[model samples]
Target: MKPAEAYILNQPEPFKSMLMHLQILIEGTFPDVDLQFKWKIPFYYLNDKPFCYLNPSKKKGYVDVVFWVSAHLTKYNEYLISENRKVVKSLRYFKLEDINEEILLTVLDEAHQLKDKGFYKRS
Candidate 1:
């Protein structure tokens, strides 16, 4: 298995299940994305550019879905949780059932579209 897949499988209990579900959603949402293991986490890239990453924050008791260019995603502020971060923003999930699928999908889709359209390059 790839290191990224292994990382998700190694997670314990509910976190493992949550990561698996999230992996499915991400793959389904961006079928062309490339999954790579970097900085000990799963990072997804689009057309060779950083897009998003997944982390099961065991210490924080939540999973973080981090968007690389979140600062530009002000229109979706209600769905983000950066917590004083400068560039990236994230959505946190404490439980599998707590995931807002529709919002998450929308945010991910927007992020992908933004990067694809060269929004990051314009900055």
Candidate 2:
């Protein structure tokens, strides 16, 4: 198994389940995306560019599905968390039930559209 997959599989429960669910959702939505282990986390790349990453913060008790081109995302701003970061935003989930499929999908689609436009370009 790839290190990225292994990382997800090795996470503690609640986080493990959430990461697995998110991996399915993201891979299911974009078949061409590449899952790579980067920065010691699971990062997804589209067309060799940073797409999104799955970060399970055990200490924080949450998983962050972080998008690189957050500056261009127009829809679902209410659902994306920046946490004072400038170049990226994320959808944070504490448990399995917190993964809102509809909002997640929409935000993902929005971010996917911005992939070719560079990382921090304004929409």
Candidate 3:
């Protein structure tokens, strides 16, 4: 397990379970995507560039998938945009059981396409 994964597992209760679920869902959707710890949180990267981060705030009681490199997403994906500057451009907020599999897969597919087109920096 990655340091990030272990960290998530160490979290208590809802956070641990929710974090693990999100990680599994994302990993399942993009089995080839790379992941690491960034800013003390789980960050998912495509081709080494910033793709998205999983925010599991135990205090705030929410989890969001944040895409900082939102510049690569077209208007077609604007529906996922977040107005909060603290968050990445394309943000998807979800509760413990609210994860939409299809939407997640679509976003993963888009990220992969962007990575393949050399839209991201390589590690």
Best by TM-score: 2
Provide TM-scores for the models.
Answer: 0.91, 0.92, 0.80
Please give the lDDT score at residue 86 for candidate 3.
53
Model 2: residue 73 alpha-carbon error in angstroms: 0.3
Candidate 2 residue-wise lDDT at 20 = 95
Question: Could you tell me which 10 consecutive residues in candidate 1 have the lowest summed lDDT?
Answer: 114-123
What are the per-residue Cα lDDT tens digits for candidate 2 across 88-107? 99999999999999999999
lDDT of 3 by residue, 21-94 (tens): 87887888787677899899999877667778888767767677777656666644755756656545644444
Question: Better model by TM-score, 1 or 3?
Answer: 1
lDDT of each: 0.86, 0.90, 0.72
lDDT top scorer: 2
Model 2 residue runs over 4 Å out of place are 116-123
Question: Candidate 2: deviation at residue 76, Å?
Answer: 0.9
lDDT of 1 by residue, 1-123 (tens): 989999999999789988899899999878988899999999998777788999778988999999998866755688698788888899899999988888888888888778656864433
Which candidate order results from sorting by TM-score in descending order?
A: 2, 1, 3
